[model samples]
Target: MDKITIQNLEVYANHGVFPEETALGQKFLVCAELWTEIRTAGRTDDLEYSINYGTVCQEITRFMKEHTSRLIEAVAEQLAEYLLQTLPLLKGITLEIKKPWAPVGLPLDTVSVKIERCWHRAYVAFGSNMGDRRSHIDSGIQVLRDDPAIRVGSISDMIVTEPYGGVEQEDFLNGCLELETLLTPMELLAVLQKAEQKENRERLVHWGPRTLDMDLLFYDDEVLEEPELAVPHPEIPKRRFVLEPLSQIAPYKMHPVLKKRVKELLEELSDRE
Candidate 1:
């Protein structure tokens, strides 16, 4: 939750919509607020324990100069992602890109774009019921692991379970995983859907069977309800396959909507059965 601030660092870069702006280049001001744990660095007085502001400043300068974008918003967005990916110790970033000397023939101070980006903890439930089920699930996990924007964490053991929804299909190999990602909820969903598509997942039959199934169960204790997505996976409490593996990895993780722990939900479901 602690922060290190870098204010108004000037850089010369070529980033604008107009031809003159890109050809001749212009001066830009960048500001950054780095969020991380500074307690260890503060106590040990070791530079290694903390993020080096000097190095970060240089990185900002280099990134600004190297990338050319049509708008400051794009510049800020790309720069924030670059810094977060390259800097291991940086947990979050607030970035601002200021473009002064506007081409508009008016008396204006400057144009700027500011944004906040951070890592989010998310849990995903994966399963497969057809065609080398284990391999399909494993491949899906690997795809997530390989992505730079995602850091795969503790994974629950895969369990065999009967098919849900009375689909009269083969048993499924189901499991859950913990991951840290910089992608937003929607973007994360796209990544999971991509992995499923690679294995040729079809939606012809509702919960009937599939090559691979990836469900977004939770994201950072946040509750979301959209047309295509639902956080805490609306059916978490009722799905034994989801809870069994999820409890193994996150027994104490509380459901933001239901206000019950994973282990508690599992126990409650067991009592009913």
Candidate 2:
């Protein structure tokens, strides 16, 4: 990745815990590292091919002056998000918000919060066994398409699959999705849960019929086992519906834990069953 480093841009803003800090205002210094591909820009010597540092500096100055928050943390987060959204060529941002004149009443260098935010690739599984199954899946797709940070890459043709669990239910329409997103794994989960909730998904009957079902099957080859969520979805490798859709977009993608490509795993599972 190519780098564009903008360091210690000065801004006069009102941001602090104390009321006086907001009232009197203070100086803030910001540093940002914008990541992108600069090969074309370098070859052509064109501003259009690469991100314009001058424009970014102006943007930062304007944003800091116009948007005032109580904490620099919030300022940094919003600014990073803004930069990512506004700069089409940028892939990631490392933002450092410095508060030099913080009212700590001690000899100190500076107080700042630094964060690295970037887009992530995620795979989602969609299913519905209840009324208007196709509509349910379509609605979910629309929601993802509507979001700015989420880009729908590819979708597998919906396949009718028999119910997996012991509980008897109607056949489900299942498929997988490939998404490029700026949302973290947890944030992506929230989006999925929100969509499910919109469809009135319930936990009443385990694996029972539902209006819409969405699950996070994989997140950037990440493996995590938390209380509320699991990554690489635990059973995705064993489920043909998951593997089939996933293989469509990322057939050769290797599992972080299993060390096998999605297509290979799908073939193995098919051989057994």
Candidate 3:
């Protein structure tokens, strides 16, 4: 990834903890490193192929002036998210906000807050075995699509499959989807869970019938094991319902732990049965 750097762009803003500090504005220095591919812009000498630093600088100035936050950390975080969401060309950013007029009694040159933020590719598997299965799945997808931090991409055709857990249940409508999101894994999980709850998903029985079931199958080839969530889904190779749809959309997606493509995992699962 190539970078476009903006150094020491100064702004006068009213962000501070103290009432006096907020009343009287202060000078701040902002620096940004925007990550994107610049080869095409360089080769064609086309500004269209590149992110305009001038426009970005103006946006930063406007954002800082318009929003009032008590902490520089909040400013940096909000600004980074705003730029990444609004700028189509930017893939990632490292932003630094320097506060030169800190009110601490001890003399210091400056206090700064810096952070890195970027989009992550993730796959979510969705299913429903209860009433209006397709509707449940479709509504769940819409919830993800409507989120500003998420960009829903290719969707696999929903398939009807028999329930997996040997518990008596209706066939499930299942599929997987690809998405690019700015939210962390935990945050993403919360969003999915909320969607499920909206559709009246129940956990009365393990692998029991439910109105919706959305699982985080992958997140940028990341392997995660937490108390509430697991990435790569832990059972991808064993669940044909998951792999079948996942393979349709992302056949070449590699598992971080197993180091195999989705199609390969699907094939292996098929062979086992």
Candidate 4:
């Protein structure tokens, strides 16, 4: 990735814990590293091919002054998200917020918070087995689409499949979609869970049944495991329901661990059957 750096751009803002700090605004220094391929811009000598540093600086200054947060961490976090969402050409950012006016009652140089954030491509699978299955899936997708932070991409056609996990249940209408999001893995999971909650999904039975089921199948070839979440969806290869719909949209998408495309995996599953 090529780089465009804005070093120590100063802004006057009212962001702090102390009442006095907000009452009397202070100077803050901000730095940003815009990550993208600038080759086109350089070659074409066109400003349209690149992110305008002047525009970005103005936006940053305005954003900082408009939003008030007690912690610089919040400023960095929210600002990073804002820029990524607002700027189409920018792929990532490393932002630093320097608060030099901290009242520590002692002479200190400066206090700052820096963070790096970027957009991620993710694939999510959706299923619903109980009552009005298609509507459940469609409605759930609309919910996800309503969020500006979530850029919903190609959605696979719905398919009917038998139950898994040896549980007696109605046939499931399963499908998947691709998305571009500025959310982290965990943050994406949290958002999905909240959407499921809106559908009244319950986990009383494992793979038993649900009004809406959303699974995080992949996040930019990332493999991760936590107590509550797993990436590449551990059992993707075993679930034809997932693969069939996934094939419609991302047949050539590869599994990081298996090193096989979705179509190949689906074929493998069919061969065993």
Candidate No. with top TM-score:
3
Residue-level lDDT of model 2, residues 1-273, one tens digit each, is 889999999988888889999888999999999999999999999989999999999999899888889888899989988888788898999999999999999999999999998878899999999999999898888888888878888898899999887789899999998998999889889888888888888889887888888999889978999999999889887899889878888898888998999999999999999
lDDT of each: 0.93, 0.89, 0.94, 0.92
In order, how many clashes per candidate? 0, 0, 0, 0
Residue 172 alpha-carbon offset, candidate 2, angstroms = 1.2
| Tens-digit per-residue lDDT, 23-107, candidate 4 | 8889999999999888999999999999999999999999989999888899899999999989989999999999888888999
Model 4 stretches with alpha carbons more than 4 Å out: none
Q: Which ranges in model 2 have alpha carbons more than 4 Å from their true place?
A: none
TM-score of 2: 0.94
- Say what the RMSD of model 1 is: 1.0
With a 3 Å backbone cut-off (N, CA, C), the pairs that clash in candidate 1 are: none
Displacement of residue 35 (Cα, Å) in model 1 is 0.4
**TM-score, every prediction:** 0.97, 0.94, 0.98, 0.94
* Range of the 10 consecutive residues with the lowest summed lDDT in candidate 3: 129-138
2 against 3, candidate with superior lDDT: 3
lDDT of 1 by residue, 16-112 (tens): 9999999999999989999999999999999898899999999999988998999888899888988888888999999988888778899899888
TM-score-superior candidate, 1 or 2: 1
Clashing pairs in 2: none
